[model samples]
Target: MASPTRPGPAVAILLARGGSKGIPGKNLKPVGGLSLVARSVVAARQARSVAAIYVSTDDARIAAEAERYGARVIDRPAAIADDTATSESGWLHALGLIRADHPAVSRLVLLQCTSPFTTGADIDGCLAAMEDRQAACAVTVIEDHSFLWTSGPDGFGKGINHDEAGQRQRRQDLPPTWRESGAIYCVRVADFERVGRRFCGPVALYPVAHPPVEIDTPLDLRLCDMIARSGEDQTTGVADARLRPLKALVMDFDGVHTDDTASVDENGIESVTVSRSDGMGLELLKKSGRFRLLILSKERNPVVSRRAEKLGLECLQAREDKLAVLDEWLSGNGLSWEEVLYVGNDINDAGPMQRAGLGACPRDAHPSVVPLAGWVVPVDGGKGVLRAIADRLLALA
Candidate 1:
């Protein structure tokens, strides 16, 4: 908490390390459609409480990215340049730099590049939590006790439970575990300087009770990439706005998600094939904590429903007009077309394509649909097109 008598301006310092062992240059690697570091920088810039944003890094490329997203640059010292360096050190350095020139800086927000899913609300919520409760620090927490395990001095296998039959206990019956999701952190600048630490004083915990994901390893990055395609960012001023639950992702199934292939059999059955990789990718997208994945196809085919069921996606098959179906979906589900992302690759898809606020098109989409696409993917149809597009959508967002 800043001195009660004189609360000063709030500043956000994002620390980005360009080098990574698991995924080289992961911070710079494109996620959804933007660099990993840019996600944090943009979120911080959008926070109401944050007055100034700064990026501290030793790498020139990282420094440039930070500046690109509207943040002051603080060249990190080499002593804290290696993998062994703690983020706390870099944060302190950037804080000191600010305090030296600007004595009125009161609160400091810490943003990380690894957690791309953190929205503007996450940042504001952390800062608000600190100020509202007069706490010295605040951070984002994800509650999980479902699949935890620990080892004691005996070095034995454990299920994060004493009894293997723990599944019989109700969810609330067991103790809850908190994981620091490295999304948002707020601290009183004065206290941070006084104690030379972040988590030392009276702290407030704000649970991120939405679809939350973190990018740590390559696998985590891939999962984060999947989360980006869910159209959760449909709300205007998401970070600053009150937390709103995203109900569904109304998607177009034909040329948008598939290659629009067909094969004739001896029985005179038409089977328009789909990409196996794209199907698997949708399964991953469905696994995200948030989003109601639905497939909207104008053509009637049992294969679409079968694939949707296998991927745990809802199928709205056999609709002549996707717009009419989208309207019914919104009416029944109490949503707006703008809240959805219509990914299409043909002229028939243009109706819903223009309706969704977040629209996407395949690289090989019809020329008519290309001009209306919010995101035109790079992959061709019938291949890993959806996955490639999904990856960019998540990163850009």
Candidate 2:
């Protein structure tokens, strides 16, 4: 391991091979509203010790995406990118190129694109552990408590840990074990080159309390997508400087405020449920006295007016042209689109969302609006969407 005062910058290398047998183009697939490779790049950017990020891949699309997310691209050779090729070959080749241009680089952090839940803190922790323990490398691991078994040539199962003659032991009495999460690997560059391997000398295991899901098959990807959409993943917090200077907050009424659902009785009466937590969040935002909140809706329903009155916010309903109305309102208030944070859940709201400086949407918003949104809150509409956005704004304040 290197000392804390190591004279060079720590570079992070993310290897994403294009050819995946289990899932084709898996690296480019979206997870948590971000591509797998892009997620790795974003997490790497959050690490304070990582000065530069490089993506090694043979696919041109992956290269373009890596550059789009602020990472240098290394066009890996096909020989080293094949299914049988080990990651060490790609790392060595990429390191060779990086070291040629950056002679002062002292450490290398290898990040896997498959682990979408890996955070910047995890990467920093690995690097910190490496230096603190004076170990040649540090790898992320998770505690494992599963019993082990092995099959003999005769097709008989045998206990790998306990004796077959002994009675089954309690799980708590079993020895502690750890398994690699394949989320992160940090190594001393000099030692790595000298030994031609990641674990050339003493290795340290950095245990992750709750490891993010790893995408290997279609089911894994789907499970991760559901977790992200449900807001169960804790790594969705996005830190953008633009969120700090927000002066106004505009939202759509149907799906942004309500769940875009309504119940009607035979008497032709309609009712919608609204979250009290959302109202409290809005109240807190109003107390800040820094933002002007408004609701823009295309529906001409009294429910919209009633909810607005309860929240003490100005309501504009029966407006088919939300963008035009929003423009007029902004000009009347002596404000510009740059000061507004717009939240929408449908195509109609896309125009205003795109026009606003900071566009956001709820987790279950329309598919078309999700990509255009700068922030996709974890809560659904008529739920805690407003509260989530309000909390994010308050944090920035």
Candidate 3:
């Protein structure tokens, strides 16, 4: 008897085709405040067995989305992107490219963007099944109890699982059958290469309790959105554990509070717009009694002070060196950097953001500041940035 093959590092490949006949731009469609491709990449990142993640696509938007979620992109060819093309061709191309740099990867985990409900645990389960059973491939399946039927050439419906002539059997007495979920597939690299197919040799079925949902039409997309909004399809929590025990919430006024825009009058007086939702968020935080809020701005504009007063937050203005002011204020209040959560949106806020314990920014924040931010809200500034952060903080509280 031969010993079972040990599982090795595996690379997760997510195939996101750019063209969709049923639903246009379906891959980039947002579900639960996250793009479909981004959700898949995040799920893959959560798996411990997955060493790296790669997205194969021909669409520029999909490629950018994949990179935004921290996944390498494999530019798929046009030939393989047509409706007649198959997913296997794209997978083979991606595997070849990945093997060029990561030769140690022995297994391939194929994920579909259509199946948004697939979790990281499902991928790990499939990998475990392949290793424990010593099978060449493992595929996800859902326990299906429906009686199957087929159409004959004579245009008559015939039973495929039971004899139509015999008495109907009880549902409990029916034999167990499984339906392909089309969510996840894990296979040995060597076996896949040998047969050029996902199921080359002995295959194992990994069963999951949740029914798989694939987005193939507009109805499917709307159903997914509804499920996500209902909080039933929430795959992961957006809150970060490192933001706990937060004492102070500091923020830059211009880009962090407003939309990074100012209307200047002929007299050089400027005004900025702020979100009412953001003000409500500040009120909630203040009511929590767990956090002290402050606004630090480089501009000496009275608008900043006025807005800060409206929110009942302490305001510091005309600070050329924001970090110095922040440190001095921390020391004066007997607070440390570890207890502060700073939010900024531009290069001016970069230094201070880095000095804080938890740094965050809006979705439209400057590129340089984004890398420094520990959290990036889904909404832009002056829209719902503060509201989003406040929700996360309140959840922790």
Candidate 4:
């Protein structure tokens, strides 16, 4: 990472206020298969000039999610967490917290979790602009020349044209203008503290004209969802179809979630050891108002059944030919294969795992299964494997 060019000391402040009147909890909402917070965290970390990343939020859930995504969380005070609190206010409060720790922070990069389209490259470029221009601050904008109507100091103004009979002017003849999109803002920390505004004297404009639409309402969220999911992987540029809501989460039993260990009792009953970390991960995943979970196990052990029931997971035990059982379960539940994610650990699971829309395995999974997985959780089984996967998926929001 290149050192930042903002005066002296610098840090990135990611503001994520919990309350949203236009779109509730929109900061945590998903875009491109990730929550808005997750996307920002990833991008911030990727920036070359960023030394550290902090997420400011009042909601414990948002803080927990941010930490899981590798961002430091600063507990946003109630005074600055209200719906009416402006971004400028949050920036100042976070600055105070950052200054106390570093004591010499001279630059503050105010990042909003509301927009997900900005990339780490965009952030690095914006910061680099400060180094190049030696300006007080740098802000992002997009060129927009579409037909626009403006109200004068008086209300009710018309479009640019005044006469109906006039020939349509060429598009280039119109004045080109840039609109602030709140995608990225870079400023000197000392300058920001002195003046309560995000921008200061000699503000440089960083044009990020890449196609962007900020999420400010339910309609905006839905539209971005459509753009992210339906967009083709091809170069032509169309958004992927929005992912349908998760109906069910199909998980594997041994080695995929729980450690492959068993304690044999004096009476010859076997016990499979599980981890509390795994349970914690599941609770967060379930709390997100997404899928109904189902655990499939080849073993018929009573312990497996007990644990599944304890976690509110539907269990299918002693299941051979796992695909057939999965099909039957979907038919009975009126669900489809594409809505399910199959997690597994060994070659035996390959057949069933391949049939699901998304497949995952732990890093310690069988070598073959690792290649088959769409995403491999970082931790081994009995660890926070599920949580790793959930956090990644959540960021895609």
Best by TM-score: 3
Per-residue accuracy of model 2 over 210-275 as CA lDDT, tens digit each: 544688999999988887666445455555556666799998998878899999989888889899
In model 3, which runs have C-alpha deviations exceeding 4 angstroms? 1-10, 45-52, 117-181, 200-212, 231-252, 290-301, 314-361, 366-376
After superposition on all C-alphas, the RMSD of every candidate to the true structure, in Å, is 11.8, 8.7, 4.9, 13.5
Can you give the lDDT of residue 99 in candidate 4?
68
lDDT of 4 by residue, 1-397 (tens): 2234435655888988787888888888877556788667766765657777899999987897677555788999999888678888888888778766778777777787767676666777887787678777888888776666667666766566332236666666667777877788999776676778987756878888555678888888888777765542111111122124445778888886678777898999987778777777777777876776888988788888888877877899998889999999999988888877777888778886678866667756776665455444446776667775555444445
Model 2 clashes, total count: 0
Ranking by lDDT: 2, 3, 4, 1
Q: Mark the regions of model 1 whose C-alpha exceeds 4 Å error after superposition.
A: 1-6, 152-167, 210-212, 233-397
Local error of candidate 4 at residue 71 (angstroms): 0.9
TM-score (C-alpha) between model 2 and the true structure? 0.65
Kindly indicate the candidate among 2 and 4 with the higher lDDT.
Answer: 2
TM-score of 3: 0.73
lDDT for model 2? 0.84
Model 4 TM-score, all chains together: 0.58
* Candidate 1 TM-score versus the reference: 0.58
Which is the better candidate, 1 or 3, if ranked by lDDT?
3
Best by lDDT: 2
Q: Per-residue lDDT for 87 in model 1?
A: 83
lDDT of 1 by residue, 1-397 (tens): 4445646788888888767888989888766655777667767765666777888888899887766555678988989878999888998888879887677888888987887777666788887778777889998999876756677578975667435554566666667778788777888876787887888589888888644566768888887776665555421123211213334566677665667767879997867767878876666666654455778887887777777787777788888888887898788877776567667878888788777756666656676775455454545576777665444333333
* Candidate 4 least-lDDT 10 residues: 233-242
